[model samples]
Target chain A: MNLYELTIGEAHGLLSRKEISAVELTRAVLARITEKDEKIGAYITVTEASALKQAALADERIAGGDMTPLTGIPLAIKDLICTKDIKTTCASAILENFIPPYDAAVMEKLNRAGAVLLGKANMDEFAMGSSTENSGFKITRNPWDPGRVPGGSSGGSAAAVAADLCLGSLGSDTGGSIRQPASHCGVVGMKPTYGRVSRFGLVAFASSLDQIGPLTKTVSDCALMMNAISGYDNRDSTSVPREVPDYTQSLTQGLKEVTIGIPRQYFETDGLDPSVFLAVQKAVKTLQDRGATLVDVSLPHTSYAVAVYYIVAPAEASSNLARYDGVKYGARDKTQSSLLGMYRQTRSKGFGKEVQRRIILGTYALSSGYYEAYYNKASQVRTLIMEDFNTAFKTCDVLLSPVTPSPAFKFGEKREDPLALYLSDIYTISANLAGIPGMSVPCGFSQEGLPVGLQILGPHFNETMLLKVAYNFEQATDFHKAKPVF
Target chain B: MKITREEVIHVARLARLELDETDIETFSHQIGTILEYFDTLNQVDTQGVKPTSHAIFLTNAFREDEIKPHLDREKAMANAPEKENGYFLVPRVIG
Candidate 1:
């Protein structure tokens, strides 16, 4: 296999044996990015100079007998995560030239692990849209098919991993941003339970819902990343104070005692593609053959997840995004004289169409006289959605479903219809609403050869259970090994 | 559930975003559809259901009241669009 194609585990083994240098691995990945990123549009910025420097430092660390699993592993970061001195644009023109003065909590951890930063991946502007098409920057194409989207708002990270542009990547999931794209790109992506990771220095899109996780070529790599990034920090008050267990320890083989819940509502969901249903059904049978029991469960309020998510996520986004008022960091409109005029102009010109649309929707929902009917109602229904999961988890260890209704759709297929794009996340959005962990593992491919991902969800802070099932399935199936022939 | 152009413009103003005539028309129609979809939530019986502003319930996270190092003035002002004497300079607000 090529150097760029090695998983984090494989590359670490090689680096630890002193067979290949960190600089060699970083250079190979950077060369792959330079060769393929133009066609893929997976990166917003490529940090070649800093990446090599970090790799050299990692080499020194490895030579001095101080190396972690991620030492010298090159990874892409979703553009929303703040990297000090690097231009961390959330794929928006508002912060196009903006540079952060401090690293995000995840970046600080990854840096301490001696990981090499390849670049910042692209995403939807402010992470508002389902497809990367909403990005103010370039569009990221699916590695499987260049005409289709790579999914968003973590499209770039997913695409980079799929195309061997990077070994693994960091992606933030608010409403299926990580899992949906990982499904589309045929990779493994996990969104830890809310508060499992610190949000400090992460460019906030929807503060209450957003959580950063990993997208990797393999489930073990995902676990490696989870081990490195999951922890509590005083800087982010929302960071949970609970102890993080060693996630890799849960990667056992058999699922003998595991009970997977099949949500009846998800199978009966409207617009679920037959191919996706068949693939997930086959995966269910495969787990059963591996000595796991399947139980029929019902998350009755699953249908309302999209509606609740649209209202709640956008409402939080409107409030969190109020910080960009032409005063501090990011773009400003100098042509306007008055403060209000400048604020209006800077925002009007800085934000893209979808972002502006969300801001308007969120403001209208939270407006006086309408709050009770819109925002409050949505939050109450959100409670029902969470309760649905809590009730279902009582009968099973994890819930299984298709990650998306179908595989990656062609660009512009759903771009014109915002409601359609919102509905695409019907399966994965509930995890974010309920603050539970969800993962997308490559299951099979459609007849058209597009990838299909099997989504596994577990209770809050139960990421270990989800990872075990995913790891077992991955070891049993070769779907993850099937790479997109670009 | 249908939002009119007037309401769209009103929300835009509240959001501190200036919308053009075309944008107002587009958003009016689009937001109306989304709001109509949101009307589905009313079907659920949530009479006394409490709202969940956050997924996890955690009390206020408090730290000891002590002076610790924070972002210095220069670093804080590094990304400011307009700065004067280590302060973010905005347009005149007291006029």
Candidate 2:
């Protein structure tokens, strides 16, 4: 097998046995990027020079017998995560030249674990869009079908993994960003419960909803990545003070006695592609036949999730994004002589259309007269949505649904219609709204050959249940074994 | 819920964004449609429910008041669009 195609677990075994060095693995990945990235457009920055240097250091660590599971593993980072010396452009022109001086807490942990940095992956500008076509630089194409989007704002991370540019990647999920892309790319994506992973380095979109997780070639690799990143940090105030188990230890063969709930509302979602629905139904039956019990559950407030998310996310985004006033950081409009003019010009020129739209929506929602009518009302509905999930978890250990309503759609298919694009996230958005853990594992492919994702959702901080069920599902299916021929 | 061109311009001003006439017209239509869709939130009865700002309830997370090394001025101003010897340069706020 190609070194570039090895999962984290596979590569770690080889590295620890001295069968291959980190430099060889790093070079193999860099070569793959140099060979194929022009067609994929999965990276904003490749970090070739620094990646080799880090890989050399990882080899030294392995020689000294001080290695972690991620030691010497080359991985791509979603551009939103801050890296000390690398240019972390959140795929926005505003921060095109912005270089962060400090490393995010997650980056610090990865560095300590001796992981090699491949580069910064592309994302939606400021992570406000569902398709990476919103990226200011370039659109990330699905490796499965180059004409379709890989999904965003973590589209690049998923594409890189699917195309074997990197072994595994780190992606942040605000509203189904990671899982959607991983689904589109035929990879495993896990979004841990809010606060389970530190948010210190992740650039904020909606502070209350954002969580950083992993996109990998397999569920076990996802667990290994989680073990390294899931812990408390003083930097993030919301970082939970809980014991992070060795996530890999939860990987077992069977799902005996596991109750997988099928959310009736999710199955009855409007505009759901018939193929996706059929695929998820088959996935549920497969789990049931493999010793799991299926239960019918209902999250009655599912209809209100999209409405609540749009308002609440934008409101928090407006406040979180206010920091980019062309003064403290980011580019400035030199032609404007007045302060307010500079602020206005810099922002208008810096942010993209979707970003501008959300900022305006957020500003209008938080405006003096409309706060109670829009933002406050949305917040109240958000509480009800959380209650619905809490109630459903009582009857089932995890809920099963389709990650996206359809397989990967072709470029420009839904880009023009904003409402149509928002509805694509109908099944996955509720997990984010409720601050629970959710994941996507490849189940089947469409008639057109695009991958379908089966979503597994667990209650807050119950990633173990989600991972166990996903691991069992992955072991039973060969869907994840199928790679996109690049 | 109807976002007019004037309202779009007004909200842009509040958000400190400069917009052209075409952008104003387009945003007026787009924002109006999205908010029209958002009208579904009004259907839910939230009379007695408390607004949740965060998914998980958290209080003031305090830490010991201790001295920690701060970022050096050079690194802090590394990405500033305009920078002086050791500070970020901004438009004059004082007359």
Best by DockQ: 1
Per-residue lDDT of model 2, residues A1-486, tens digit only:
889989899999999999999999999999999999999999999999999999999999999999999999999999999998789889999999878888888899999999999999999999877879999999999999999999988999999999999999999999999999999999999999998899997889999999999999999999999999999888899999889998888789478879989999998888889999999999998899889998999899999899899998999999898888898788788888889999999999999999999999999999999999999999999999999998999999999999999999899998777878987888888888888999999999999999999999999888888999999889889999998986
Q: Cα deviation of A49 in candidate 2 (Å)?
A: 1.0
Ten residues in a row with the worst lDDT in model 1 chain B? B1-10
Per-residue C-alpha lDDT of model 1 across residues B1-95, encoded as one tens digit per residue: 48988889888889999999999888888899999999999899999999998999899999999999788889888888999887889888897
**TM-scores, chain B, all models:** 0.91, 0.90
Candidate with top lDDT is: 1
**What is the per-residue lDDT of model 1 for residues A1-486, given as tens digits with 9 covering 90 to 100?**
799999999999999999999999999999999998899999999999999999999999999999999999999999999999999989988899989988999999999999999999999999887789999988999999999999999999999999999999999999999999999999999999999999998899888899999999999999999999999999998999999999999898579999999999999988999999999999999998988999999999999999999999989889988998988889999998899999999999999999999999898899999999999999999999999999999999999999999889998998678899899889988999999999999999999999999999999999999999999999889999998888
lDDT of 2: 0.92
User: Cα-based RMSD of the predictions, in order?
Assistant: 0.9, 0.9
